[model samples]
Target: MVYHVLNGDALVSGFKATGLSGEIIVARECLIEGDLKGETLPEFLENRARFVEDEFNEARVHYYNNVVPEFEKLLNAEPGSEFNLWFGYDLFCRANMWFVLSLLSHLEGDKEVNVVYPSFRDKHDIWLEFGRATSEQLQEAFDNRINFAGRDFRLAEDLWTAYKQTDLGRLHDLSIFHSPCFPYLPEVCQAHIDRFPYKGKKGRPERVIEDILKKNGRDFKTVFREFSAREGIYGFGDDQVRKIYDKVMKERNP
Candidate 1:
């Protein structure tokens, strides 16, 4: 059976429009913004569940009902099943991809996993080009999925291990592998590292946002546009960027 593991619900319609006969499983949780510590799998889920509740102001029930089931799909898949992971090249998508690959690495099976990248791409704004792609274009991407060799999975495993351990240095070193299947991995890893608090005790993205706001005044629409144009690699939507803006201004004015 073919299982399509998507990055999020945003790509569901485009994927379903392809008329592909497969189970659509979405990775509902965001791993990029939470603590990555736990001795066991269940404990890890609980920690993430709590983090999601606090960070998103969501309830634990939502995590159990919405998030856990999707991961369960990955865990319970039958042996020899075909898995196609549809994730973007941004840090957010790459984090989830790393987790999925880490899980798949442990699963005992004849797992033939492939990464279905964006088919219709934009060189300038490549991170978001797939979001505006047509359904036919998405299908084209699926049809030309990139299969992983043994070494690719091993590389994914190492990268994920480093991420889980919060080993930024290891992640940077591992990113140098330059896997054929994941050309943007080095940039993604650096983007992840860049997310940590840096200059002026702010994340590089946050610093850029603050600078944009300061230059353009409090007009959020203009600030967001500048941010997107300047740091498209972050792949931050308005809502996410707005959260940062709200916090920065709160601290600045108050």
Candidate 2:
């Protein structure tokens, strides 16, 4: 899929081929600029190369884990339908590549606002799912999906808020609920809190149970008792509860 960009209402070359070509050009430019220097140029190029290498690693992961899986699922279901499937698939690949480029552009510290052109023709999928969502339910879904895939929390949070006005409460609730499997989920909530972007600073939970109770509006003691009473549930003794309590308190205090 060819991804185009609109600059001042004029359509430009898409990122899949053009944008990558641009990156290579920039790298060459950097090398030329570095050549003018005596000692610092090598260090500068080394740092730039490291940054590019890191971005490439991240892009590969995002492609394999997020982009490819979605395309594979669609391909498996459809088999040999060639009308829009291939086009859409190619576009999605470009979009994912564009997303990586977007991050790289930021790291490169370019003054011009470089818009990352997605390979996909339609921007709906790019924004609706790949970008951040505004609705509470969709935001939660996106958060959970990111956590399950073990993506960068900051990136997930940025994507969550880019396209919509999200309620911080909804994000907090979702993060806490999904924290066990998604250990880094707490970082997104923390980032939100650090910005003071919303009202009502309900105290964060110290432990998993406390977090669940606070987020879900449940009584932790009652829930624990019920679970303990259930057969084969309380494999650990009361010491486990004490340990959990201690850990929760420590986190809260710390």
Candidate 3:
């Protein structure tokens, strides 16, 4: 599995292998461990959380040193995977990406800072290339820090409103369900979904997937295809997507 820290807060987690099922779990483990400002509660969870956090930080450095640089090179070349787009479109991805970018940007031109900088500079450059200015702009808008709840609230609300206006959001819900990791995926996706009202109903986890698919003219494959096409420069292959999907399923079911 590979993980990319977007700004300084969130991590965009992915893998290189096909049908590898552990990225999401790893991501969740990292989140629980990092505690992002020590927000995670329950005193007993702290020890386990610290262990996870340590592991996540180690993996992150390892990925930056070895895997991420290579992936960045691929993204710079032609026929790259749409991984960047996948992250750009997803709320979680954007939040994570932006936070990481912001942090690195602040650390810019400073060799003394003890932070891992992505091999690919201007990590948010792809956002500009794709015309998804909101997230890119938001990254600039916020102080180069994670502050998920603080800065992410406005961004999340905006994305939820926009997604609710389109058929694609529903479709995403279906793809989430087909995965073996539906349990975990739904928890994350639904947290965002429930924040808004769609068709006079507050979105529920149990029915979100079916509800999305049932909506007229909603096509998950097509949206994914378009997303893939736009993000071709990022070199996110089918294998990576399948890996993330499988991993989420296992974690959810397990």
| Cα lDDT tens digits for candidate 1, 20-110 | 8899999886777777888787899999989888887999899999989998888899999989999887777787888998888877879
Q: Lowest lDDT 10-mer window, candidate 1?
A: 120-129
Better of 2 and 3 by lDDT: 3
Whole-model lDDT per candidate = 0.85, 0.31, 0.33
**Candidate topping TM-score:** 1
Ranking by lDDT: 1, 3, 2
Clash count, candidate 2 = 4
Lowest-scoring 10 consecutive residues by lDDT in candidate 2?
Answer: 25-34
Best-fitting candidate, measured by lDDT? 1
lDDT tens digits, residues 75-138, model 2? Answer: 2332222111110112122223223332332332212222222232243232221222223432
The local lDDT score (0 to 100) that residue 13 gets in candidate 1 is 88
User: Of the pair 1 and 3, which is ahead by TM-score?
Assistant: 1
Tens-digit per-residue lDDT, 1-254, candidate 3: 22222321133221221222222211222221123342222232344345443744544445445433433432243231111212332334433433333323322222111112121225544332223234334344222222232233333434333343443476354434332211133444444445346787643322333333344223546433443444333223354333333443454469
TM-score of each: 0.93, 0.19, 0.25
